[model samples]
Target: VGSASIRPPATAGRRVPQGNSCNFGQGSRACVRLRGHALFRMAVRNAAPAVLGNALTCHVVAGCDVAAHAASGDTAGGQARGQAWKGLILRGWLRGGLPCGGQRCGSMRAGSCQGSRADVPMHGLLNARGQRRRVLVPPPLLLPLLLLTLLLPTAPPRCAAATSPTTRPEPSPQQAAAARGCSAEALLPLYARIDDDLRHWAAHGISEQLMDKALATQTTASGEKAIGVLFESGVPYVVSPLEEIDRLGHHTGLITAHLRFFEALRETFGPSIPDVEFIVGTADQPAIRLDRLENGALPYPLLRFCKSETHADVLVPDIHFQMRAFNATLLQQLDVINSVAWGEKAEELFGRFSQYKRIIHEHIPTLEVHGAGGENICHHANFELLFCDVREHFMKWAHGVRSSGAPVDVARQPRIKMIDHARYKYLLHLDGQTCSSRLEQLLVMNSVVFKEESGYHAFYHHLLKPGEHYVPVWKEGPEDVLEALKWARAHDDEARAMARRAQRFTQNYLHPDALACYWFTLLGRLAQLQRFEPGRGRRAYPVVLMASEYLGSNAGKAYVQKHGLSRMELPRAKRVEQRRA
Candidate 1:
């Protein structure tokens, strides 16, 4: 271990500092004079533990040569001397003794210790030669004042640990409203009910008397009264004139046209008039009112509509025979003209005519085909060549048949063999003629020409009238004509077979009851009435009846029960109800 030591001065220097170390250990009050003019320097070499109840003082002089040597960059020799000097000062203060004044001062006394005043050094030995140098004193007397300066109030400990700011929120009106419940509204209209017997009369052309009798005994659902009538009839009309013309001949045209016209009229006028049973043909017979017309005649009649209110009748001409004759004559003339104009080798002419004939055969019936002999006779005449002459002749023939006689009343005529045949044939001819004429008129009005070379040509012909401005002209070679004619013949056979089948179907299934049901449904819807509601009030509900029947064995009963409606019988007197205010 290396031992280090610090030596004190023997005499006081020329200018002794007040805080310099002094030596005072001998017993007398004599001062030890030190002569060397060296400075008093102190350095702390090690930090000592602070003594309790002691005041520590550190003094640093401006021009002192205090040299230190530390082993670990801390507490070196000079620093240790400084620390020791501080320790000595602190020890003197703690011991309540005065500090050593200077090298020339008297030795320190033991009883000369009291308070902080004892820590201050006297000024007598602060100069050389023991001269008095204004009696300088250390600032230990101001120690309490220095401590007061360091006791400043620190910031509150909790306040030093604060953070940021805060905020708020809002609401939505739409969200609040949705939480409750709200919606919109609307409005509708109402209708009145009619008498059951009258309702049936208005719908199916049935007698009100029958309906009244049936209803008088008929029972209804509990809490509900019957206020409408139900008529059961099955009738199917030839509704499509074009289709009818294709199936039937020109002779059926009259009836076909009438049917079309009446259907149109009903569409236009039926909605406006209530309580009207529009009838077609003659309604003078009791069977007509009774809804007892024989088979096909009742549904597809030559007459159109019969308005009960005005007793008005719309008759459609029955010209089936006329059209058939017309078509036959025209074809014959065309063949004769082709044979004559082109001679035996007139292949082109023949082909053209053949094509024309094909169109005719495709649309018209075979009985309407004219023979070749007649065609040659009128070949030179323009009208004859064009077959107009044949058409005129056929028209005259139709008129003759119509004017011949009143053979049998359609409704009253029973379905006996000869009688039914006559009625069916006559009606068929009439319907065919009506359809053919309409087609012909339409063609002519449209300026459509039937020329072999031109095929079917149409020109703008305002003079031909609005509905009949388009015409078809045929154009084909002789070969084409022959082929077309053969095709037409084959097709005619097929059409006849289909027609026969249709007639059978109509006779078996399409009855008066069926027609009554169809008409009831149609009129009910037109009148805006509801189907019979049995559980509902006696007030009549506007309904539109559909033509189709309900399924199941008890279809009729089920319909009434399910729909909650009541039905009145037929042939009843009209009921009189007081008008509501």
Candidate 2:
């Protein structure tokens, strides 16, 4: 059948690889060398000048068309053809004469024949007519030739899938940023916007209009003086970002979030702003003017501080810093609670959710009091009092679930478990009296963060879109939580996108460098606003006094005495005249 029945074409010898495994044939008879495999039944084309002009010049046999493999129900024939094809492709690699479009198939090794095996009708090899003719794909050459056909870059195929006519390629920078999602190209723009906003605020004092958006109406005068003196002083202060929680000696868990931010801030911008100080404002009304304290007293002692978060006069740390949890992927699934538990009830609540499904879990109470409280005064005092406890709501939900035979515990679920569960499940983060700092961290995770609407705003709150960035849940009850979870499961892709968007947003706006730059930029603007007196408040002040108690009475007393412009006095206790309105 080789030469007797079929005439040999000019390119036939060149097309067939130097292998005894394959033979020129049209029947299902096994080629002797390929006794274990079936041969491709190819139809030999007549040796005539190719009719297809300017295409690669080569002879092709039309037997069982390779395309037939796709539609053919003959599994045996398909297997034979595939094995034969692999053998031929291997031969092309052994022999150098095969025109793999002049390109070497380095990736296609004998051990690794796995690649795009789509039978590509490739026109290559230039004949004497200077016209291209179809080259019969050799066994080894089949792989490389197919590869060259793809890699040789040409115009889009006429029969290719249609694309929207409105589509235009993104700019290189944006394309690169989109590819990486959170690279500097994407983040730097957000950082620039942050820097610009802070500069605007620093150039001008906190605006009356901006202050009107306060969640709180009143502020402590002593708190106001402490911040004012710190802001006015041309010195850097090293203050604990946890002073707000430490003052009440409660809400211990809240400190870890802010501490993460301060530590990151020190790591990122510490070198740039060596004199930077961290500060937090009145928990109730950071934006309000603190003219009177609870005791109706104006602030004194003039302890120096630069604002850290909440206040615009001083630099503010964004959510990225606060919510940055430990590397989520490396974290283990087993919840770890190494710290001391407040009490037995707290222990039970804060204990690990051993069999918790990868669903939304929020151990923090919907009411007040974030972490559990201990029976002892020291343990009880460690938790911040927001004056609103959601123990009843949590109990109802927990009891209902447990009664239904599924014991649900949202009370404890440690951070490690939270992050681990987040990878494969939806996470529900309920806000207590104020917003949860863990919200940012949770949102950054791969899981969908179902958030209940609240009055609190992090630095990045303005950037969060309801459906686009997070799944919104009502503060009403567990039903809404269930509904939100249902929606997330139904629209899984959208939920995942929201998670990615949330992550990208945090990486951009809350990046350590971005926050650090915001810090310095705010100071630079504040420096312009300062009323510089000759030899007065213009040395690089880098000392920060951080205390939850009266600054003059605590470690800040010495700092105030040494750095205080006026003889510092322990701020007088608020006159008992008018209070508790």
Candidate 3:
């Protein structure tokens, strides 16, 4: 009887149509409507095993007698049975029997698994009662294409988690200390007590736009801020111009040295800080240089000003042309702006204090000075001021020396290039814009350094005492240069001792580690003085320093290169000379 239900009996109305060979039901209009549905189900049932595997093939092969049941007019019973059959098919599909779970997954239309394995032909077949019945299936293949499709994701992946605030990782220990809010908190003690006061300083230089774009990102221990810029290559950071203030005529070497200091610090510390955005101001000198007030108001809270004088939040070393000694070989090769050699420590370049006199003895007279050039006892005044230009104060002093018929040589005119220091026993040191890096270099040379007293000083300056490390000359006039020259000639042994003392100070205090300590200390103090608006805050410098440590010095270089930042050029005596003129 079951077989008969599957293969219905042929009767007067059930006779096969002219081209069709299906027995849908006994003589009835409903039977005509069913048409080729029985044939379609039978063909599919028989052929599907080869395409859909046994798991799915069995469902079609053993389908219920829907045609007979529906034709009997047992509406309630037939509908229940139809639902049961549908459930069976659905279960089979969902159980990984069809590619991408077929229509059973509810993501696609029934029986139309688009892009399914083998594109098995499918159609909705009806029974004798005109109710939808079985779906047609095709022959299976050797490949488990359906299974493969089932394994694939139903929809595209999303990036929502990455952007979610909750998903963001809490900052590390160092980061917590450098967080924007923490930076604001740290500054609370030293800066504006009220919101208006903080804003006042920000408006003066550090605008919120500037903070959001640069200063407020993250913090590092070394206190280096990376400006957003692109390399001739590429890096992954906010790209912006390197210089914040567009003013020209500032010292670019100062900028480069600051960058290298950060790079070296980051290379040293591992995770004590992180990288952050930074913008370099184009100020010609520190905002508050010495006792001279360049600005009557407070500077940007985010700025780490190279302390011009006392009462500064942070103290930064003067541009250490000392960095140049390391690039002795490469300096001549790079472009003008990129030529200020740095990244090497002072101790590394010239050895220890003990070896100073010997090295100076060997390297002195590196080249011969024309016009009455002689040994340490030359006819020309041992004093030679190889300056591109002379300040009025220095000029007046030089004029006085000439008027007094002093033996010292005054190369004060513009275009007077740096000459060899060997032939002369007395070397004259001067300050143009601020303290010169040449001060450090001259102190190391075995020659007697005749320094003019000025308000400007450096990290190693305080350690230098008159008559102990150098011969102090008068800044008001040129008589001091002559007076110092006379003293040096009169007391050769004592003058040499002063030069030795200067060399010792550099050796003991200017090592990279020592300088790094100074850098770290200055940043720490500066962080303590920073203040912020009620909610607005920049990152603590520590975090910025740590990030550099994480990314490493090489990464820093990559960033600079990617942004196509040129090296900061050391101010040439010639340029200053031109400016003075």
Ranking by TM-score: 3, 2, 1
Displacement of residue 451 (Cα, Å) in model 3 is: 1.3
Residue 332 lDDT, candidate 3, scale 0-100:
32
Q: Could you estimate the TM-score for every candidate?
A: 0.17, 0.39, 0.41
403: Cα error in model 2, Å: 4.2
Give the RMSD in angstroms, all C-alphas superposed, for model 2: 26.4
Best by lDDT: 3
Per-residue lDDT of 516 in model 1 = 25
Please give, for residues 1-581, the per-residue lDDT of candidate 3 as tens digits: 01122221111122111222222233223223323444334533322222221012111211221111111111110111123223333343211122221112211111210113323233212243434344433224412433443454433212234333223443442343333223334333322212322343333444445444344342221133323211110011223333331122233334435554454444333133322233333222333222333556443333333323342322344434334432332223224312222221111111101110110111123211111112131122224312122244344445555567655554434332232342346667765444455666666554567775645445456567888888886444445465567677678678667766775665555544444444433333332333332120333222222222223346445544543333432222110010111
**Candidate scoring better on TM-score of 1 and 2:** 2
Candidate 1, residues 305-415, lDDT tens digits: the string is: 211111111222222213233233332233332232211221110100010111111111211333223332112323212222233333333344335542212221223
lDDT of 1 at 467: 12
lDDT values for all models: 0.23, 0.34, 0.35
Assess candidate 3 and give its lDDT: 0.35
| Candidate 3 off by > 4 Å | 1-257, 274-282, 289-313, 319-405, 412-419, 528-581
Clashes of 2: 36
Candidate 1 TM-score over all chains jointly: 0.17
Candidate 2 residues 352-389, lDDT tens each? 22221111112223221221222111122224322333
